[model samples]
Target: MTPIIVFSVITGYFGLLMLISYLTSRKSDNDTFFTGNRKSPWYLVAYGMVGASLSGVTFISVPGEVANTGWTYLQFVLGNIVGYVIIAFVLIPLFYKLNLISIYEYLKDRFGLKSYRTGASFFLISQTIGASFRLFLAAIVLQIAFFDSFGIPFWVTVLVTISLIWLYTFRGGIKTIVWTDTIQTTFLLLAVTISIIVILSQLNLSFDDAIKLVTTSPKSKLFEWDWLSDRNFFKTFTAGIFITIAMNGLDQNVMQKNLTCKNVKDAQKNILWFSITFLISTLLFLILGVLLYQYALANNIPIPERTDDLYPLLALNYFGLLVGIVFLLGIIAAAFSSADSALTALTTSFCIDILNIRKTKTVQKKTRLYVHIGFTMLMFLVIIVFNSFNDASVVSAVFKVAGFTYGPILGLYSFGLITRKKVKDKLVPLICIIAPILSIILNYNSEKWFNGFKFGFEILIVNAILTMLGLWLITIKPKTSLN
Candidate 1:
């Protein structure tokens, strides 16, 4: 597991992605970059999304979390299934019927220009931070495993990380991502499966014995019935539903891929198939967590201070060179899968939603190329910032922040879909801003006011509700034509 081998593996992986990008970007246009010309195969999009949705955060953090929280995360995963179903039936039809390139266009048609820009603004901010945090985690791991050995600085690693993604994704956009993501997803899943097999062999446990071991272990406990706990099944499940809606259905990064499909039917199939694969993939990660813990306990190894470090520690140091290589590939694949798409989505949102590049129909290629490069730089700077101040668990930090930033998106979409009331267009920004602030205050003091009850991912639900209520306060009845 020398740094040279790790570096070589990463180089080879990036080369493959670049090749895919070149093939996809040939004779590409703005339509190809934005929507893949509405010609993407549903099955490929479904398979690729498994990697983008999970990202590097899930790759490293989910297994780390299993040691502390056991199987309760599965409750969140179940809730995601419900959310995906809603997207397939409800959101996909709306996007398709409107023939939307940017989903935020619905906001303009439903409300006004202010609402549309507000929605896109929130997404840009949300995806920028989300993408940076994800890359930050992956960069940190690379720094420790490879760069540190050579005394290479963290900032250089961040630049190289982002540069590689930009190189592959700059030209093809969604079209390229559709294919690269499938390859990355395959590598990610393969890495995890192989690591699991290696660990199982080390433990000398058959498949049935491994299943029984995890099922019977103390960490196997799944449900939390108490309402006061943050991990309460009801709270986590509800949060999962809203999180998926906000983070996927309303998100340009996720929805952009869905929009690349041939039609609503293809998009629906993609969502359905992706949801099923995502469920199975998550379950496998949870099982991997249980095995890692059992192996550590049996071998008298001390668990790392940060739970996220456990999988990397075992794969690199204890499991053998092959396992370590797999771990590196898995994490790099997970990171690139999400980051490349995020960059494209941000560029798409800004060019179409903010700058209205499609409407001008002039110098579109140049504008999009510049925006893509701009976002890549922005992401690099943000990841550097995260390295300075980040101390909490990466997965928890992502969801907690998402609850606040994505809350307005949830509220905006909920209001548009559920009511015919028109809101004060100029005041929409104020409402979106206040909702997350109030959610922060409430989350910070829930224990004092709610008799010691804590908020979990459910904070997202509360934030969206507050935003919706604020919108309702400013709503006015639609005027009918009296011809």
Candidate 2:
């Protein structure tokens, strides 16, 4: 597709989202922005979570890695199913029971003021980086496909991308995102389904032939039993369980939408259905990955050095004009669905956790507006910084950071939920900070120190354990009774 056509496609898509924003935000209030007035339909939230969860990182990175990693990510997805079940049954009920706007409020109730702040602070730091990573992929795509033609610097593209999200989300917040994300999810699914069909038609391969090839190819290997390898099934599976719990269950962004459902039953229904779809959609991405590698080999196309670029390069340059336009829309949808919510979630957290705005209810609407704009700007800066230094696959980078950022969170929740013991609330901030730093040191030296025991997705598990151990140490002892 020509740059003009690509730009037009994006413009029309944004216009559609803006229209949805206008409709959704018509009677917006703090309740609408933070919790969607607790009236969102379970089904819409279910479908929309898929797009927000996958985002551009998964859209680009999953299929790209298929050539090398095969279907092993399915191990993580399987683990995620288990994780989602835990969230649906355990975490969802707790959030609804408390009627929480920010999930972090539970920490305050269970522990003390310090622990509450610690959980909210970790969420803020981790989510900012995670959201930035997701947005960076879309920015890269736009720069390559359209902006370069106009001699536009990458920063301008980043600004425009972040600003559009701010423009729509500042008013309605999660209320707008719930509707916008459903629309984004529809386009995302359409784009993937169309891209798969186009590739099959181009290769003249029947469904049976495609399946047969994927099953037989070494590139489609799904199991890694090498205990020393980073992609071992056990590590990936366990890590998948904890990562989901930490990133979605413990983190604000993912849980924010679920808390918007009318009640616990409705929210549980949303999560349960979303997990099944999340697994199937990811499976489709893997199938596409195998097809991408096979197609490249057959046509004598040189694979891009950074495998993350493979999907975009093939779609935009080789898949024909129609596929290019759809793929572009898919990525944009993925980007906005994720980033827009992160902005809302961040604003919600800051207003609730940091500023304690509920105490000063008079200024909430005005305060939320300023906080929303501040996060939008923060995300832009983070993306620009990432663009300068990013070298690893985005999926890998995100997971690696999650290992550090989410580790303390997973630890805090585990300690609070599993045990009825009192915590040294004042010590929690110190413990949360120390756990991640220790995790970094241990992850850095594990291979050399442990005779090639590599930490992959399991880093989150290790970090959480360390955090729990720290919490255990700081518990108060009961005095002996002399009767």
**Total backbone clashes of model 1?**
0
Minimum summed lDDT over a 10-residue window in model 1 is located at 357-366
Model 2 Cα displacement at 37 (Å)?
0.5
lDDT of 1 by residue, 1-483 (tens): 899899999999999999999999999989999999999999999999999988888888998898788999999999999999999999999999999999999999998999999999999999999989998888888888899899999999999999999999888899999999999899889888998999899989999999899899878789999999999999999899889999999999999999999999999999999999999999889888889888899999999998888888888889998888888998899889999999999999999999998778475899999999999999999998888988888999999989999999999999999988899988999999999999999999999999999999999999999999999999987778998
TM-score of each: 0.98, 0.98
Can you tell me which runs of candidate 1 are displaced by over 4 Å? 478-483
lDDT of 2 by residue, 1-483 (tens): 788898899899999999999999998899889999999999999999999998998899999988778789888888999999999999999988888889999999998999999999999999999999999999999999999999999999999989998998999999999999999998888888988999999999999998898899887889899999889999999999999999999988999999888888999999999999999899888888988988899899999999999999999999998889989999999999999999999999999999998887385799889999899999999998999888989999999998999999899999999998788899999999999999999999999999999999999999999999999999877668999
lDDT of each: 0.93, 0.92
